[model samples]
Target: MSDGFSSFAKLFSGYYSDKLGKRKEIATFGYVATGIFPAIIAISMSWTVVLIGRIFGWMGRGIRGPPLDAILAKSIQEKGFRKAFGMHRAGDTLGAMVGPALAFVLVIRIGIRDIIWLAMIPGISLQ
Candidate 1:
């Protein structure tokens, strides 16, 4: 499942992002998926459901990475490219740092299944 997700994400996300010119959407989707899927897993009583959610979430992330970088690069000034990329990278890392801890808490309180619904938070903003 992991391998399948990895392969699918790499190819499909890139393709769709390019075709749609929606890298930002991909990135947003990726983040939302991360937020929601783990929450679902934390809430879910079954491992099978968690696995399914993880696969879907991972694919969103995989699709998001390249297009995000590209879009971010395009959106910024050439002279400030380094700084811009740096800030984005930093923010992404920070989000990663916070997400797991938050997930831990959310899972403890609400379980993983319900937590997955939170993924819609960012996704909603995207539209």
Candidate 2:
């Protein structure tokens, strides 16, 4: 359902980042924006709020993706570019795997409120 936002954000945000010459700032904002609303989702008292937060969070990711990719490509050597991107993909996949497993364990022990807060650590660190 939110895939549309991701697609649009990927396109437009990439354009915006390129035009503004603020790759770092835009990328960081996108990443930080993603980090924030999960906590909001965790704490929100209503479904509407959850949905809104979810949309915004996905948008941030869409915005962040292209800038990060551009920066990453620029930072690496041509010969090792594939390797660098492969590593980046692997890290992203690993985080996806680890995050849910960690959350499952933590949710059982610490409860939702606390787990959500604990889950927010890396996002805050990213910001």
Question: Using lDDT as the measure, which candidate wins?
Answer: 2
Listing every candidate in turn, what is its Cα RMSD in Å to the true structure after a full C-alpha superposition?
3.4, 1.3
- For model 2, residues 21-59, the per-residue Cα lDDT tens digits are 888889998888888878888889998978887888888
Give the Å error, residue 20, model 1: 5.0
Q: Which stretches of candidate 1 lie above 4 Å from their native place? A: 1-4, 19-45, 105-120
Model 2 misplacement above 4 A = none
TM-score of 2: 0.92
Best by TM-score: 2
Tens-digit lDDT track of model 1 for 1-127: 8557856787877788889888877777776665566555656678897788778767767767778878878888899999998898899899899977897899999866555666556755655
